[model samples]
Target chain A: MGNVREAVDSGTWSLPQWADQPPDPDLTGASFLLISYGDSEAEAVVQQWEAGLRRTDLDPPVLRFHASAFDRDQLADKLAEARCGVRLMIAGGQYDVLQAMATARALGLETGEITRYATAYEDLPLFCPHCQTTSRAYAEVFDWTDCTGCHRVLTIKPHYSSQRGSFLGVDTR
Target chain B: MTDQRRLRVTEVRSLCPEIRQITLEPLEGTALMGFQPGSHLILHAGEHRNAYSLTGDGIMPSRYTVSVLKRNDDGGSAWLHQHLAPGSEITAEGPVSMFAPVHNQQHALLVAGGIGITPVLSHASALAALQKSAEVIYAYKPHRAAHVDQLREICHSAGFRLTEVTSAGNCRKALRDRMSDQPVGSHAYVCGPMSMLESFLEIGAAAGWPEYRLHLERFEAPELDPGEEFALRVSGSPEDLRVPVGVSILETLESAGYSVPNMCRQGVCGQCQISVRSAGSLEHRDYVLTEEEKAAGGSLMVCVSRGTDVEVAL
Candidate 1:
């Protein structure tokens, strides 16, 4: 188990790293999607990933595996059972998600293949939910600020297009 | 901002099975502004970016705490438990302002479930630090309880009221009663599992807590209903890429060698901002856009938001 961390740190995961001959990896163990914010972000990110699969024509549908939040033990058990290979573990945050990605990569599982980085967002506009005034923007768009109106923190959003690419908005309430 | 600087991890301790409580201290030679009692930190854990509440006060020695609960079915927790050893260096952003406590409220009721207790733990401590009394109701399944010793110590030392509910049989009933007893000036802070959070909100709403007084930090964002696949036409590319109902646009673009800047892919930050050149309608989920921006259909964060069966040229 500890070796999994080493693998991720060093960027390596082999097929036989955490399993005994690739036992029924998907079935005997459960797959988890431990999201930190809530269901909305989880579903939104999952949906986005599913869409990516179709665009790339990645066979077997990434969504076919499905996503569900798992706790510590549940996640570990699934990884162990997934001895057949390393499974995808998308991260909701940098520290938390990276650790998961690293561990999966370490256990001889393909690091990049098993974990993905997705954003955790509170639903709605770009305004600073705290201050409600200063229009939020990312590093390039605007010098990021917590908020001038309410002092509430603001998170960056990614726009699908190029111009007006993700900026901050106000909280209506 | 000059006020908020990255605090360094001073110490880490295992609280219970699969749970680690991290103590953070301000870096030497850096002027660290104190965090509001209920502030939280964004941990850059490996590839994932997760949020955790600060258990310590905002000011110096600038102690902050985060509790990590191991997952059973995923690789994230195992990696954290195994790799996060003493003296390991990592970066933490903010003592963010997501969990601030209301100053004007007459009575504040704090409810926490499982690891959701992190933020509320600080709230309770803050109320005590301010000499303001608040009631705390900690709910957990009877089988998985942790941090009794530490929680009890904080509760008693802080002089704040505390109630521990173990039996699943009367959990909701107990929460309802405690909430009902509070006066009009009370503000409620609720954090926990999705089901419990929903239940608490329903009961709180029934008891007349305004939507604003009740603050929430969800363990995971809510999922949206899926529909027919949409066409995500990549800019600078000729082909119209089809994004199925449940896939992400970023992955679609990335697989094509088109890079989109992103950090926390859960829609918390606006790192992966893009424009919907043309689309049916966008189901915006990222927290970076202002109301005006979303209204203008000018910009969107592709990390999470999606479209409804239209051509979105990103």
Candidate 2:
């Protein structure tokens, strides 16, 4: 079910490459399409982007947000209308960002077409192999957490499956 | 370059006056690798090598099929046309998937011009097998249109729509309107003359399509103007080569008693990538590198691209 890789700078290969804040995207590349989650720092992230582009004749990026997470229906509607020179950026909880990425990918968005920013990794969605249960845990790669379903201690894997939208929690012992 | 295989021509058919469709299978008993839709094979005949788009399904293909446009040059097509009899053997390199369809792609806007329909045929087969509805716009002169009957049959069988245009103007006029009807996550692939490809790219870009969703294959282009002469300094070496206007960097490197691993000297093969340690300006004019790869400025294809006051790692 897995393969492997090496390690180097920028911390490690497994971690999603993003700063604590979403960096300013190259505005001239493509018109931005921002997807933010609920009333929080994410809303502020959206507002920060909106205010920065008042000068140019660039089309104001369309913002699609959900109260809790991303609304697939609305997201699909907006994306359907999107043309060639478009860039998509999604920001939310780590789990929700992964989910949104998977959904967008399913609709045909390639890595070059989309960008992601995780606002919170504290509530990382951990999927336990033994109990087959998914639970949120304050864990990092190689960290240990217990499954709520079968009560088995699991080690969070470095490998993140975008399709499953969760980090694998392997019970080594 | 190491994995070379010989394939025997199983069948050959004259698609039209200028084009011929040839089917090839393993010369000996061996399983050929399955290919993706829009894959191409670099066929070698004598001193010339050319890449031809496979006009069949990618799944564990028993025989590879390609439709070639006879340009009258010795680069495989003219040779293949000259030797069209069955049982003829030829060496081939790969079923390269550079211009393939994207995975999990919702809809495809396949635009082809003249001989560019070869890959689009493969894509149509793929979309049909998946039972996905797609659109195919083939632009060609009435006499030059290959695979029109086959395309019509595929359209009849599958849910695909086939629209034929006599000129590039008609296709360009129709492309914008057709793109709007696609669902989210759709990709538009254009394999044609440079003008058609440019128009599709322009339309897609103007309409807000991302670079990832817009795919194109350019086998031919108007002759590139000889760039300005520049002196290249090899990193950590005393060698300084003065590259003139008419010659490429690879030829210059060879002339200076240096050997670089390369093929398809015209820059299509991408076998001649070198580390661009530093440069004053890099003019990347190859089909291989992605936008990010070119922007990263680490390596560049030595064949077509040129740099000024550049220090390259030999």
Candidate 3:
């Protein structure tokens, strides 16, 4: 409910340097956990995160999951075991990271309790407003994406849906 | 003509020493319009207009029921309690919606304090009918816990959880624990005294609840803070109307011949929202707008929001 970092716009491609910094001291009181995709891009981001965490006294726990192997049930179990006072750091491709955020929300973690740093923008999770279906797209840049549900071309909107945990795609055609 | 319809009181019973439950039916012998859970009807008794939450079943409700807590020197409740008898006719405006359950929520946590339990009761009933999981925490004075037997029965039938915390109990700690245990996508609805509502909101937020997941319904109007006199410049109007120090923006606009649609004049309803063409030092007092909307200065609820001097697109 408190202020979470704003979604980085596609136009603002340069990531903030502070986003690479260790979790803020205010968040250090809780158990620090990191979730990252197993891809090379995400691995580089995790390395930075580990280096940042090592600079501090916190020995944070790290977990990596492949996009195909990310089991929501396992994540739910881990979240249940973490209980209260857990600060989570997430890094992955846009789609992978959004899936993790959705899981975190399902496990009762507020946006304020989780920090996200997008590692790769190659893939995006797009929600078709027409048929209310969400699918992934692989594109270097977001423009018009085809919806598998409605078979319509959708233009990705600048806005994101916190409820859907995905980028909203409006029917442009 | 007002939008009010005449209804006859079919039954009246004292729920507690200070609270009375009145049941009404349409005089035309037709089913009243279906209202969503947490909807309220405004009783128009002469010049006294007061909003009361409909406590009966929202789905195909046969009779509209409301519980009024009698207050000394309060003409509305006092007059209804003393003079209104069975078969007596009354005028009521609407089942306007200010609070309702968020759709597709995984679970619902309802918190009610004192007479604020009116709307919470309806929400619980609706959640039960929908077979959605719900937990209701009702905080009240130990001696003034009204309709406990009936509420327990309803919860039992609906498979919902009910926790009654008295004034002597540690209600805050209980509420905090419940909020902490709620799963993700769980929505919380609270209606109670201002202090209790504020406390629940703070506790829920601290326990990782998002703003969209939390709902509130305040039974009383917002307290107004004194502001300096200001002028309202209506678009296409020749004269700029002066809003006195104590007058609300809605009152000033109404006096200036603008029929601004409004309900829950306390600013809870978004009906009176008006686009602000330009403004100087706008003071926003409504609960409807988000922080970004308020900062953007594009619109405001004229019922409660004001400014030193502002130009509005009527």
Candidate 4:
């Protein structure tokens, strides 16, 4: 242990750096949750984690859900049922992860209890610094998009804002 | 550096043979900055400086209250008990938050051991002020037990019970039973002796309590054993400098006129981290480093950690 929860909650984990080996990392909690984005890469992540749990011989309480399977209310209900040590993992495209992160934060799960790994960077929520407007991005790092509010060409910076669950967009002008 | 506040002692009352509560008001200003609950302030009186946790409400407080346990040693507590008067003026710093309740906690479990009850009191006040519920467990010797009545009053309004114990065995049993009964999203905040804190942490981990959910504030630093003498090499110091027994590597470096970036010289803070070019074997006593980092032998927290035949890159 490292104070991973403190780093994430403080927003110092602002810069986006997905865990390189998400599935293999010693993900800990009393109970485990996997909300996959329905992508092939994300499904594989859930499968490996499930297999590891089996290998450990601890039949821990686990909840599995597709990103689209439940609405925010249902997700909150499910999270509420689990105790404090529910390790919530989100594996998906950037957009789905962003959408799910909002629900986690709202559920008061404001710690490293939640782990995220976005395998495909698509449909990310971009915050346009120029106009303070948020726009959906079908792009990844170093990609360009037109801001929906100002219609200005914006470049997505690698910096992440966990407080906003959105990518920082510098006006490319 | 933090700004120091000028305060005048407004009142002082002896709670027990071992405990005294002091109340302070601003020496000049009308109000003090509000602080987070479970935070401490360093009292600066003469040449002595010691941190005492605030025992009252942290919000818009008209005065600050702290309970001091008179120690047998000639430390700050003894000095304050002997010298502090109603009109005495002193300079202090902090309201620094080493321990604070998580605002999002569904339920809060607070534990206090002996004089460590100071911060736990502050947490209870904060929880009540915020209209939240908490279960407080306090263990102390009956003769010197402090704040039983006050803890009762606060817990009454906050809709929780305060569990008080006189013996160590009963304390352990109470903690074990309560640790298993907390609701989801519950958090535990503990302030106590080094051994008690260690035991609570171990028990919490064993019970599947997440590390982030368990908060701890230590009033005393861990007692590290003095190890075999070692030789040090640093950027600003001579190579193969002999470090003697009972002397920390940081102190040794400082005596040789080398200023090392450091704080909490007790090894809790990672401020004194230095790269280890190589080492024979490092006895890692610091809380800041992980087991993997300690095993890697690439870095050292010189404040308390010691190593034999170590070469420091920094």
Candidate 5:
């Protein structure tokens, strides 16, 4: 859509103020973990992540796999590494990565992803076969993958788009 | 300079199971004249507004109409679709002008994918009402059954050209053939998924329309990463200011007094794109730039795009 402000005035308009200097993301101690469901999902996720990462030199780490392959042990290892810095991981196809995250939390790992809804998961409890704990955090942060459970820090990257807010790995669930 | 009017919801009507038409009316005694053909409004539902094209002529007594469809995947769509209903009022600003097809052209062809048909549908309606010549190529996935019967009826009454390509055929080849057959001065408008938009851009550019004539509307959400803050040096300024992570470049620019023209700060319109003098990748979310222009790396939409610590002549 076009800017309605410009459509009306049709004259020389001013942009918001800015310095000519560019912004940096690495200095922000950033690393994003991109998790895709399968090899096919890798291209789009990678392209999107890379496009967003252009403003920064720090390339976010990516882990691409099918959700069916998500085991509790593998997820725990990824979450343990996120504590050193600000990390972003994108998982495609809602439940695979998210279910794995839920399982990792049940195993007492830092892995967590929540849904934004205020209600509880109405269905039967889906548990990690390893930990045998019913994963409840997925109820709040809907369809996202991150390791926020039992972690030292849950620092959310500043100024990130709210479109990804549903994907936040908060323990609020 | 009187106080300009803010947009308000005048009416909301559900056309189908997931399709709803929201009519916005400007308050009385407000200077909200109306919107141009092919423009869209950003309905501020909450923190972010999903940009929907103006499906109705803005000439009515200040009521702007936008047809919204509920997509299961998009959070913004899911929120607006699930929560919004008739008589539920919210803040409405804009009739933002991005991806407006240039007027007075011989043939204005519009291609839409699924719900991408909204903007083109509006444009075709306006063109036919004005007795102008235009064609619409609407592509829908198989069995989605998005309410196009009303749109077809509207197009029929208006006497505009309409073509629907269902799942059985290839849309890109059809588009390429139609585009090639058109004469000079024909402009194309595309709005859909990013991949579809990219494909159109690549094909349409190779088909040879001028940079200004090919309009596009992108539907992807702007991705933001606020890992680190940086210093911003405005042109013709002595002192530099520190911009913290998560603060938008437009907000930073406004705070420093160099105002750039922008509406729909969600990066849908190309208004905030600055001409960069250095090499950098642009996080393109606006409908303003062509794919060729985007690949050049000189222009970046400042509202959502971040730079790699290199200075550009804004």
Candidate 6:
């Protein structure tokens, strides 16, 4: 997919975080809290997050929603007033978290500023650089796949795009 | 030989008992290369080279200005304060930048501690010139508030908010209160002592502020224990090189005829980063690399970092 192949091959692959680090101690004082979760498996992680919040002296306004209930328009309205001190915590499958992450980035929130915990593995959301179409595929399925828009076989490299908040799909055919 | 430029010191004004503001002009009378708001200059004087933040307007800089906080042990600052005077010429290099303001942000917040106001001052001025909404919070020791009058003038003219916090009172609470009010899409630039920077970083991360949005500039290297002797194997080398207890990896490689790119050898710059193929226990000493990059074991700054025994992609 254009120059994306060369860029991905030359770039470094960020290792996944297999273990969770302790939550930021100042998270309780966050003025706004946005959380997204998927499935019952994430409930335990969400409950632990809530318990941590309870120990703090400050009580912030929190909006918790399910991944399926993630309404883009509604989240956009809620984040319209998002500011620097806002804290976000996301928990769910990889696909669900990636979708939520895209939304957060669109709202100008940085990845380092937010907390993420994946409860389940899912297909990675990828954007084809050739046709500019988005698709999802499991990492273990194949090294290449057909682009949804261009209908061309595209190679899936390990490179991630911070701007698109997704992996890149380069043309292999 | 280093790419050095000669600058003439035109003015030396004492901002306070311990701080000196020195103004320099390019001797060639030509416009210097333009720089960003948070750029710094490396001054070389009498075997000492130190990085000082440029306090002047970066857009159309006619001259360079830097404020030095004299230290008893820091020979560089002491030397400048004692020997540098009007009409004195000194050699300097670079307007290199390791910290810069986020351009796309709607609002900007700058926090400064002690003498860290140098770069923050430039940020405020740049933001004001861009007509962006910005605020500055400067915390200083009561006795060391040397440029209060100049700072007040800048804030009043730029139409941005300015807050001065003195150490004698509850300044920490005041800083936190201000930080809590930052609007979304706002970026904060911080510089100063390590303790203050750490406090802001910890609190900001906890508040869900993204790491990319919080920029930092540190004047000193992190306190690290001396490293033990180690064996290093560089790519394209035939023999295993021995690094002594006191010698740095950068020095060892340079002395071995390898031209390793570097700036701010104090571990603030990321130029000397090299890939690690295999290694023993690594002692990471640089501020540039992220935690993930460090744990990935693929990259390390050779200038300050050391390991027990390692193989590197030169």
Best by TM-score: 3
Candidate 2, residues A1-173, lDDT tens digits: the string is: 22222332325435455676676654644466777875488767765665665455775555545447656687777777775455677777776677677677666666666777777776676778787787767767777788888888887877676765678888888
lDDT by residue for model 5 over B194-265, one digit each (tens)? 666777776665554444556777766546566356655555556656656888777888887777866557
Docking class of 2: acceptable
TM-score per candidate: 0.54, 0.76, 0.76, 0.72, 0.51, 0.70
- The segments of candidate 3 whose C-alpha lies over 4 angstroms from its true place after superposition are A1-34, A39-68, A76-89, A93-95, A101-115, A120-173, B157-159, B254-272
| Superposition error at B145 for model 4 (Å) | 3.6
Instruction: Decide which is better by TM-score, 2 or 4.
Output: 2
Q: Against the unseen true structure, what C-alpha lDDT does each candidate score?
A: 0.57, 0.78, 0.75, 0.79, 0.55, 0.76
Model 4 reaches what TM-score against the true structure?
0.72
List candidate 5 segments past 4 Å from native. Answer: A1-173, B1-10, B28-32, B60-62, B72-76, B142-147, B157-159, B221-231, B234-267, B271-300, B304-314
Expressed as tens digits, the lDDT of each residue in A55-125 for candidate 1 is: 55322213223334323454455544432212354534232343344444343343323535445322222
Model 1 chain B weakest 10-residue run by lDDT:
B1-10
Candidate 6: where is the Cα deviation over 4 Å? A1-60, A63-77, A80-82, A88-104, A111-173, B157-159, B245-247, B251-265, B271-281, B296-298, B312-314
Q: Would candidate 4 be rated incorrect, acceptable, medium or high by CAPRI criteria?
A: acceptable
TM-score for the first chain in candidate 2 comes to 0.70
Against the true structure, candidate 3 reaches a TM-score of 0.76
Tell me the TM-score that candidate 5 gets on chain A alone: 0.37
- The alpha-carbon lDDT assigned to residue A82 of candidate 2 equals 73
Writing each residue's lDDT as its tens digit, candidate 4 over A15-73 gives 56676776452445666777787568788888777777767755677787775422567
Reference-based lDDT, residue A166, model 6 = 65
Instruction: Show the lowest summed lDDT stretch of 10 residues, model 5 chain B.
Output: B1-10
Write model 2 residue lDDT over B208-246, tens digit each, in one string: 676777888887655777999998988888877898997
True contacts kept of each: 0.00, 0.50, 0.10, 0.38, 0.00, 0.56
Candidate 2 has an lDDT of: 0.78
Q: Per-residue lDDT tens digits of candidate 4, residues B1-314?
A: 35788899999999999688999899674578789998787788557777789998799988999999987668788888988989998788877776777877788899999988999999999889888878999998888788888998898974687899888888888888777666667899988888778878877876568777788787668678888887888755555588899998888888877778765678764568889988888888887666778999889889899978888875
Instruction: Rank the candidate models, highest lDDT first.
Output: 4, 2, 6, 3, 1, 5
Rank by TM-score, highest first: 3, 2, 4, 6, 1, 5
